[model samples]
Target: MTASTHWLATAAAQSVLERGGNAFDAAVAGGFVLHIVEPHLNGPGGDMVALISPGGVDPSVLMGQGPAPAGASIDHFRAEGLQSVPGAGALAAAVPGAVDAWLMLLEDHGTWELTDVLEYALHYAETGHALGAQAAAVIGTMGQHFSEHWHSSAAQWMPNGQIPHEGDMIKNPPYAEVLRRLIAAGFDGGTRQRRIRLAREEWKSGFVAQSAVAFARTSHRHSSGSDHRGVLDMGDFANFSASYEEPQSINFRGTTIVKAGFWSQGPVLLQALAILDHFDDEHLDPSTAPGAHTILETLKLAMADRDAYYGDSASPRALRQLLEPEYAHGRAAEIEPTASREFRPGRIPGLKPFFPILTADPGESSVLGAGEPTVKISGETRGDTCHIDVVDRHGNMVSATPSGGWLQSSPTIPPLGFALGTRLQMTWLDPDSPSALRPGTRPRTTLSPTLLMKDGFATAALGTPGGDQQDQWQLLYLLRTIVGGYNPQQAIDAPMFHTSALAGSFWPREFHPAGVVMENRVSPDVLADLRDRGHEISIVDGWSLGRLSTVIRDPASGSMGAAANPRGNQGYAGGR
Candidate 1:
């Protein structure tokens, strides 16, 4: 079974499963296909994080997130007369990690050759795939910027001086050639593992690196409304490689919830669960007013800590203290019937938490490139990242979120046919900040994927793609499924809400104290109750909040189930 944000990617993955590939092979194939089908959401130059449980073994995190370049420093950015990392342009580019990471996973766990796995992406990119409405909508929104500033992008996305409409067949020949070259690099009659490694070498040290750096060195318009040359160079690419790490896990209702470590926002869900564990099942239900309030407050608390403490530099001791039962109860004790509007990060005796400057002011909120570029920030949510989940009959399960390098957020490199990701915007210029800009350290990323384990076997894999809201949406699904007894489809279909009360991880960071965006399908009485409690409410359309997808396996029976979000008419799930 397989589920993904785009129907085509889902079909590609399901096809792999039907052809006897495991979950890892299907996920890698689908991930590459997404680079073609969802170019407005993700690309090869972006980053991704996956939680993989191979054949019911313990899950490990595939750390595809790349670090800052050797020249990326707060002092250098300050010297350039910048207050924060620009949300767009090559100045914010990281070492592109998505392609290498996917290839590595395939080499390690997959059964097929690299040529076989890449065929789906090559076909779509070389010929054409019908562009989704959301992708077209985003391109239309960025059309003027592309034409006026990023001319190469305009040539690729809006040729003939017109924006392509929904369902228009789009082809990216340059990217297709890039894929073909990688496969060609591996055709030396070597072992499968050696062949994939050779492809990775070509990517980091050959044409992909040279072409990207050369294109980025030219000045371009940034989200800050200024022109600047990017700081990335070939050395940054040559020095980085994706690797595996132990995933952090916490028990909830007798089941182990697995997520990536402090470097990503995955632990926010675990911390929220710990706090909510103190409450009864009634308080965990998101459909009721009291339950909704409790859930919102709990998320705000967890997110506050995320802003304060989570980063590549975060220590295990601090994480352990944060998840301690007594500490969670103490934090939960702070919740009140009325909403609390303060930026409240808990006190850990020796660690002084970093607090970002906040205001009711919406700073640069209207810039299309400043936040998650796919989201239509004009009060209605459209989209952001891309996600996929797959579970095979052999018990291999995977959940992956691939984001950044969207067309709107950065200029398209002419030769490579994709934009470098602006992930550096997540780093702070403040030296004291936990996620402060530092050469060779990873910027704290919001890309998160989740896995579930029970009785020593992996049971489920699920994830979504809303930057900071990624895990928040997953939290609601877990609560509904684990506590409220809803099936995967029911939990995903339930109305969703997320708080923006804490500092945002994206560029021009802003916070809306006590702010909540929800589907209007949430009871009007409950909405009024939230308002009465001092929560600032912005109600959107009924099915516009979440883009979650999930695939679950009955470990004992080897039976599988899958579901995708109904919102946006894009996500789909399928199986044999």
Candidate 2:
């Protein structure tokens, strides 16, 4: 996908595939290089979740999300009353498992050497990659996040320790040095003993393509980009490792299926799907006028289950009923067919009720009038995307996503040029139900790399990184494109919207429409109607105009197609 927040990043990912590396190899290089080239979004310390479709087998998934440090404890926060961890505190950090996860996938599923897999990242770090409009914009706005975290993050990002203007060459030799060392430990073909003859090998056999490298290198020289040298070291590389596991899958109505592997939110998809499957599709056609009503019904049910009952296995919630079809059927029956229900508290059979009165207020007040609604440009969102989907000449398909290490609490130990992700932000310290922060537990995450199966075979591989928004985006696109008969481009290009019980709620799910911004593209009357209903609302430019990068491959053509939402600077869709 070219419109990737960083085209240079996409160019690098594509280069990996062209060099004969598979999607796994390409995704690894892309994540690394993006960290070097687009530090504002994400870096090495970030986590990743992948959904891959191996030949005849169901799609297997991977979770490299880091866990709380062995010593992190709830008692600590309770005594301190720390509701939220700061961006730089040790308490906010986790044992980064992203790198180890990548290595594990490679060792288990990748056929190429580590050197071949991470070639693009190696080059971009040793040299430098260029910046783009989208990448620049996201950093410009979030500069405060960097300043609050590490000096390395700021010194390299801030111009003379200040924010750089657009087009500035944000360089970081210190960060670059980190990438150089990593390459030296692996990439450079500085073999001590080379025979007079080069081994006769095609790119498919695992050779870094000269053409791809030069293309990416040339792209780096002319553009404006960041200098985030990765933080891996010789010792870290030697110590990094991985393993394999069977994946989990669940079938949904109308050719829908969701899969996850050991230690991920994948299983949640199955639970939600089973829950939705309980609904009668006869009245919920999404493309029709009734779709909106159905969507709200399904999302509310899914989110409620997600909020109160969902948690890491280490917690004390009973999920057996959540995944049971009978429970879903009973829950769906609770919805009043004629009217949208107000946000309220509900119990799962025997569970206690939680009345989450809607409680959020207006956000980002730089306003408009009854006549002229001023729209604020969406700054580059942090560590969002860069994914690759491949169905090899062998018909084995793979889909992988690499994320930016979050800035809030991600710390970089200078010499490594990389940062540790403060993934704790994904979890709530004071969760009223389950999925709350606990000692050594992974949070309920948004990165669910998915492989959609239809007609008993893989039809598409898709996923994105937009926190909780990731689910609605992926779900809507898949439902529209694959199920509703829309093409990939049309599916993503179509207007979109999400019902956030949190952002709009008075406190968290305060049913205030003013705090909830929908796109102006919607029918104005529909907007007015929702506002009249006490569903707080505001209007954002693209709340429903399109989607992030989502790629689909039709086995019939042996070709891949991608559609990127143009609202954001770097959304792209293309194939080799």
Candidate 3:
């Protein structure tokens, strides 16, 4: 079974499964297709995180997060007349890691060759695919900036000096050629694994790296309204490679909740679960007012801790202390029956809390132009990311969220046919902060994926794509599924809401104190109650919030189920 944000991508995964490929192969293929078909959301230049569980082995994370360049320091950014990294530009980019990570997973766990997995992506890029409405709309909205400031981006996305209309056949021959070169690099006469290693080396040191370095050295316009050159060079790319690590998980009720490590915002879901563990079954039902309120409050508290302690430098003991049952009960006790109107991070002994100043209201910030899609609906702008999930017959499961380096994020690197990611914007300039900008440190990334296991066997893979909201949406789905007894589809289809009260992980670092953005599908009574409880409420269209998708495998019966979000009218789920 395969579930992804785009039907064509899901079909690509299904085709891979039909060809005897395992979950890893299907996920890689689908991920590449996502880059081609969902260019506005993700690209080859992005970063990704995957939780992969081989049939009998333990689940591990493929950490695709790349670190800042050796020259990207706090003083350097401040010297550039910036209080924070610009939302979009060469300076905002880190070394691209998605391709490397996908190849790494394919080499270690997949059955297909590099060519086999890449063919689907190549076909869509070289021949053409019907342009998605959202993709076209995004390109059109950003057309003026691309045409006037980023010529390479305009040349690639705006054909004949005009934004392509929705459903138009768009082809990217340069990107196809880039993939072809990588495929050729892997042809160095050796075993499959050795060949894959050669490709990784080529990516780090060959023409791709050379082109990226050259592009980074050139000055480019940024969201800060100025031109700045990037500090990244070939050495940064050469020193970077995706790695494998154990996933952190916690048992909630009867099920185990798994997520990526502290480098990501993933653990916030686990932290929220620890707090909610104190609630009764009825209060956990997200379809009702009390349940939704408790969930939102708990999410806010967990997110506060996330901003305070979740980062690469965060200590394991500190994380353990935060997740401790006693600590959770203490934190839960702090949640007033009324909504919180302040940025309150809990205090843990020996751990200094990094309290970032709340700068400006998110609605007024003009520095909000990273990889997030700025779709206008009901006079408000919203953002988007990308996600994919797969489960093969062998019970091997993979969930990956590939995002950033969107076409709208920065100017395209002509030779590479993609742009640098704006993930560096996630880091702060404050040296005292855990997510502060530092040479060789991974930005506190928001790209998170989830895997569920039962009795030491993989049972489900679930995820979504919504910047800081990723874990919050996934948490809601898990609650409805594990606690409320909702099916995968039912969980995904339920009314979604999330608190944006914490400092956003994107550029501008905007925070909405006590803000609660929910779909109108939620009950009017519930919305009113939330408002009365001091939560600042903002209602959007019923389906404007989340794009969650999941695939579940039944170990006892060997049956698999899949579901995708109907919110965007693009996601799909399928199985044989």
Candidate 4:
């Protein structure tokens, strides 16, 4: 029931549920607290994306994706001969939208008042909490990133001038003051404060707002004779009006799905499911040693097709055949027990070998699990990201991935108390590709939030935090539960799969069907069968790929069940 990651985060979610708040409330609360507690993972500076279904209505996705400021580009970086921008500078910044989105949701959909929702977060920020093992672990590893910037983020994190260790009373008195100011005065004096103060001040029209002048006097500190006072103008925040994204629904593999993306991985997930419909899952269990091969082969086939045309819908290509049931059945039909990594289970020639990449050392662990490992960040940066799932009493679901982890490429706006996304970190430095490092292009993200509906009602709202592994985990967990018959926890806890789309490869490709890099513990005989089938197999640890977040609504009891990825020590879900 608590966010083991941090007591403050858990308390905030609990506060929401204790009142009349629903899944979205809990998530928003969690996100706010995440900024205070797991500051490195998420903050107001982050952007948020959520998949939500209220009662009988279809699901709606909310996008809080921040834009790459008025100007910024990989070309600019390359021109400067720099691979990446510093984490806390205008160069590394993205216009933040998570707070705006949360405020919008609170205004439009939430049942609770803004102050009610923020009370717990404000208290936590004001009254510090003891740091948890998880937070301490994240801070310890990310200190080097903190050291990069002499000012901004690098400074705030190392307060007391050093990274605090585990069990320390992590405190941020300045951030606490920021929240207090936000609650009382709002961003732009009494103007932005109207959202919260409107109810009380309706009788007093004589009150001309002077809070703006007050804020001006007390707001941001001038940056060392440097004009980089990154305080967002209240006008800028006031001008933000969330677009009414048309809700779209599609039936994929008999599952009624709804979302808010016309060009995101959400649609691609639908396409992947469509292709899966063509295959057989009747006896696809990994329990039977011999059967694991078919399971691995089937996944590989699905993944191959996923990579080829999973692009912006604007570009039409040959994909219908790939979705054809008979074709997928034929591809699955060709599976042999012993084959090379080249026998692609997909429609096209599978993903080419990763050009011999001098892999960065060996195994690198992320504080909150790794997202998009293969989707590398070439340059420089610092960041924070996290995921949360909530199921309310009415069986509604809210699944979200809110990230500030690293500002897509900007520094810490201290007064902002939020980190921008290093999201630009996702783009290819290449100036020519679709997701090429362009001036304003949003990266082709794999952070997809999904709400899987059955019988015209959302039965599951799920997603994962692994950048590229997101869709992969989302689809895998769904299959493992809906078809594979694993329980919610089992489905999430199960050893996940990921294709190593390496830089380059040849004689023995690593990104093939059945080409699995499994945890060393899976039965050797079972792995041997996968290996015999031409898979380029490697053995990793017990916990691996696709750390997922899921909420399952079982109609049988009208109750809910949930599970977080085992990779991270913290994740909690339950009905309000």
Candidate 5:
């Protein structure tokens, strides 16, 4: 069974499963197709993180997130006349890790050959695939910038100087050729594993690295309205590789919730769950005013700590203390019927918290279109990210969020047929900050995927692609499934809400004190009640907020099910 943000990608995963491949192989195949179909959301030159549970083994995180380049330092960015990293440009790129990471997973846990997986992606990239409406619209919005500033991007996306209309046949022969070359490089190997390893080396030390490094040396227009050369080099790409890590999880109710470590925002979900666990079941139902208020308030507190403490730093015992039951009870007790508008991070007994200067009014301080890529020309709307969740018949499961490196985020590398990701913009400039920009440090990324288990068996795999709202949306789905007794589809169909009370992870770091954006699916009376409780409310269209997808396995019956968000027309889920 497979659930993903794109129907084509989901079909690809289903096809892989029918071909006797495990969940890992199906996920890798689906992920590659996602890069082609969801170009506006993800691409080949991006990064991804996955949670994989092989049958009869402990689940682990496939850490595909790349770190800052060896030369990417705060001093260098400041010297470039920048207060923060640009949202879209070569200067904001980190080492591309998605390709290597996907290949690593296939070699280690998958049964298919490298060529078998590449075949699906190759067919779509070489032959023409129908252009997605959202992708086309995004390209149309950035048409002017591409034509004037990024000629390489113009040549690829806007052929003949015109953006392709939706449903038009869009082909990426150049990207196909790149994949073919990598496949060819692996043919002269001893074993399947060796061949995959050869492909990885070629990606790091061969033409891929050379082209990326050469392109970074040239000046390009950035979100700051200035041109700057990138800090990346061949050595940076060569030195980086994806590896497996133990997942951090906590037992909630009877189910265990697993997520990536502090490097990503995955842990924030766990922290929020800990706080909400103290509330009664009635107060946790998202459909009601009290339920929504309690969840939103808890999210704000967890997000405050996220901004203050979560990162890739070593020996941070503060995280352990924050997740303690005693601490969670104390934090939950602070919530009142009225909303709290202040940015309050919990202080651990022996640890001093680092708080950056907060923007009182984000509207006045934010630069227009300065952070992550947005779909609309105005840049007010958040851009979409890609997610894939698969559970095979063998009970193996995987959930991955593959994002960053959208074509609109940077000038397309002519040879590679894609752009470098601007994920480095997530890092802060302050030395004391946990997510401070430093050479060889992983950025505190917002791309988070989730896995749930029960009695040592994988129960569910779920995730979405809404920058800071990823885990927030997932939290609602989980509460509905675990507490409210809703099925996967029912849980996803329910109204979703998220708070902007804490600083955003993207550039220009926007925040709104006690602000909440909820779908109008909630009752008018509930909305009025929330407003009366001092929560600032902004009502959006009924299905405009979350894009969550999930695949679940019934431990007792051994039956599997999958469901995707109906909010956007693109997401799909199918299995038998």
Candidate 6:
């Protein structure tokens, strides 16, 4: 079974599964295909997080998030007269890690050759894939900037000085050649493992690095409307490698919910669960007013902690304390029938929380070019990023979220045929911040994927594609399926809501006091109840909030199921 954000990627993954490939192989194929077909959402120069659980083995994290470039420093950025990293441009790029991470997963757990796994992407890039409406719209929105400022991107996206319409055939021969070269690098008659290793080396030290660095050296237009050269160099690429790490797990309603560590925002979901666990199931039902209020308040607390404490340099003791049962009970006690509009991170002895400088008011105009790359602030739906989940007959399961490099993120590196990701925007310029701009330290990433286990076997894998809302949307699915007794499809189809009360993870770090974005499918009475409780409500269209995908396997019964979001008319689910 396979489920993904795009139908073509889903088809590609399921094709691999039908051809005797395992879950890992199918995921790799689908991921590469997403990079081709969903260029407006993700690209080869980005980051990914995968939770992999082999048959009978404990789940582990494939840590593909790259660190800041060696020359990326708070002093340098301040010297450049910037308070925050630009949301778009080479100046905000980390070492590109998504391609290397996918290749690493393929090398470690896949049964197919490197060329075989990447063939799907190559085919789409060399030939052509029909562009989706969302991609076309994004191109149209960025058309002015591309034509007037980023000419390289204009040449790549606009053919003959025209934006392609939806359903237009789009081809990327340069990216196809890039894939072909990586495949060629491995064809030295060596062992399969050695061949894959050679390809990895070539990616970090070869043309991919060279082309990206050469393009970044030139001053370019940034989100700040200033032209500046980037800090990335060849050594930054050569020093990074994707590796696997132990996953953190917490028991939730008889299921072991597993996630990545503190470096990512995965733990916020677990922390929210712990707080919700202090209440009865009635308060956990998202469909009811009281339940929704409780969930919102719980998320606010968790997210406040995320802004204060989560980063590559976070203290482990503080993280453990945040998940403690007594601590959760104490936090839950702060929730009231009326909403609390304060940014309240819990107090831990010897720890002083870092409060960010918030610049945007919900009542005022937002700063231009400050929106996260994953989703549009003015759109009906939270979009960008690409998620895939796969579960095979053998009990192996994987869930991955790939995002960051978007067509609108930075100037297109003409030779490489992709833009560098602006992930460094997640970091703060303040030296006191745990997620401060520091050389060789990862910016706290929003990419999160989850796995569920029951009785020591993998049962499900799930993920979605909203920047900060990624975990919030997934939390709704988890609550509905685990506590409300809804099936995977039912849970995914339910109305969703997320709070923007915490400091924004993207550039400019805006926050709204007591703000909530909810789908209108939620009962009108519930919406009114929330508004009456002092929550600032922004109601959107029905079925326009989340884009989640999941695949489940019953370890006890050997039965399998898959589900995908219906919001975008893009996500698809399939099984044999």
Each candidate: what lDDT? 0.89, 0.50, 0.86, 0.52, 0.87, 0.88
Give me the overall lDDT of model 5.
0.87
The TM-score measured for candidate 2 stands at 0.77
- For candidate 1, which ten residues in a row score worst on lDDT? 373-382
Ten contiguous residues minimizing lDDT sum, candidate 2: 365-374
For 1-576, candidate 3 gives per-residue lDDT tens digits of: 999999999999999999899999999999999999999888888899999998924989999989999999999999999988888888988878998999999999988888899999999999999998888887887888887789999999999998999899999898899889888987974898887788888889999899988987898888888889999898999999999998889899878888888878988999999999988987787777788788888988898888888888778666778778898898888877788877778889999988876754544334234535532222154557788999988888999999878998888999888888888988989998898889999998888899988788888998998888888889889998888889999989998888878887877666777788888898888888888888887888888777899999889899989999998689999999
- The better-scoring model by TM-score among 1 and 6 is 1
Residue-level lDDT tens digits of model 6 in 299-356: 9999999888889988776677888888899999999999999889998777788887
Per model, state how many residue pairs clash.
0, 40, 0, 39, 0, 0
> Model 1's lDDT to the true fold?
0.89
RMSD of 6: 1.6
Deviating ranges (above 4 Å) for candidate 4 = 1-11, 82-92, 185-241, 244-254, 257-262, 286-384, 407-410, 429-432, 502-515, 544-546, 555-557
The count of residue-pair clashes in candidate 5 stands at 0
Record all residue pairs in model 1 with backbone atoms less than 3 Å apart, i.e. clashing. none
Give the Å shift of residue 409 in candidate 2.
4.1
Q: Say which candidate scores most in TM-score.
A: 1
Residue pairs clashing in model 3 are none
Across 440-470, the per-residue lDDT of candidate 1 in tens digits comes to 9999999999999999899988999888888
CA error at residue 220 for candidate 3, angstroms: 1.1
lDDT of 2 by residue, 115-193 (tens): 5656667666666556665556655654664564345556555657666665555554554554444334443343411
For residues 472-571, write the lDDT of model 5, one tens digit per residue: 9999999999999999999999888888887878766777887888887889999999999999888777888788999999878889899999866889
Candidate 4 structure, TM-score to reference? 0.75
TM-score of 1: 0.98
